[model samples]
Target: MARRYDPDRRTRIIDAALRVIVADGIAGLSHRSVAAEADVPLGSTTYHFGSLDELLTAALRRSNENFAQALRDSEVCAGDADGGEGASSGARLADELTRVLGEWFAGERGAIELEYELYLAALRRPALRPVAAEWTTSAVELLSTRTDPATARALVALMDGVCLQVLLTGSAFDAEYTREMLTRVVDGCA
Candidate 1:
């Protein structure tokens, strides 16, 4: 065969990389591993990704977009932005945040952990910082419409902490507690 044409090869590779990361953590990723996971030739991975960092950057960026889309797609959260009708006491916003967190935690825990692993990987991989930040900025921008940017940042931080806590400690996600805590923040700002 002279050459094979696969339009979605790059995407498949990135998706495969995600799966590998999810299964083995970022530490276990490598061109050989991704090629095996993608079922493509090793050269294909290198051709598509000049370096492991480049490949990670692509995977993290795609993962970030997925998370951003989740927030963008949530009607419940959107409704609370801008205080819904008139002025909001932050209850609705808090409720929305709590609900969103509940849904996130309810999702496949491994995938969530993998996403955070990619984010935390930024600590060592400077190339991934922008990709990780994109998720935060996207979340903040979405939340900013409901409240000031400062409050939005605070909310993001709180959500991150709660999410990490749940993941690290293997504890149950308490929706009521989350709602109350978020409400206090929103209420204080209100």
Candidate 2:
């Protein structure tokens, strides 16, 4: 058989890995499984990633962008391009953050579960710890634009806690509660 060429194989493999994780979780991941999901040869998965950790690292790196990109695309986080420089007021920041959180929670449950699963995997997999931290770093960086770095870090922690609560408890997201907590963080209040 002639050697085939596929520039998108790597990206497709990474995407497939995420889908596999979403469907079966970290325990279900294997190069063979990922290759089957990606519709690529098993060798392709090994060629791209020598181990499950490497594949997971790539998958997690990709997943981290989903929420950060959402935050980046937010109106307050992006700021007003039309000279509305003050639009990121604490109140406005809180409001936009809340809205964004609601949107995140409203997304597909599998996707949400995949993201959290990747983060939780860090508890046992040392390689994934930095990727989890990277998720926090990106969110804090996006938020720091609207508030001080300290406040931004606090807000990220707050959001993470709130999200964890909603996910673990199977409770519906409360935008009002999120808004109030975010406001307190943005305002530097205890």
**Which candidate gets the maximum TM-score versus the true structure?**
2
Error of 1 at 88 (Å): 4.2
User: Per-residue lDDT of 1-190 in model 1, one digit per residue for the tens?
Assistant: 6799999999999999999999999989999999999999999999999999999999998888766777777754465445446636587888777877788888898878888899899999999999888889989998887788888888889888988998899999999988888887867734
Q: Candidates' lDDT values, in order?
A: 0.86, 0.89
Candidate that would win on lDDT: 2
- Structural similarity to truth (TM-score) of each candidate: 0.92, 0.93
The true-versus-predicted C-alpha distance at residue 78 of model 1, in Å, is 2.7
Tens digits of per-residue lDDT for model 2, 1-190: 9988899999999999999998888999999999999999999999999999999999999999999999988875765345436654776888888998899888897888899899889999999999999999988888888788999999999998999999999999999989988888887766
Off-target runs (Cα >4 Å) in candidate 2 are: 80-88
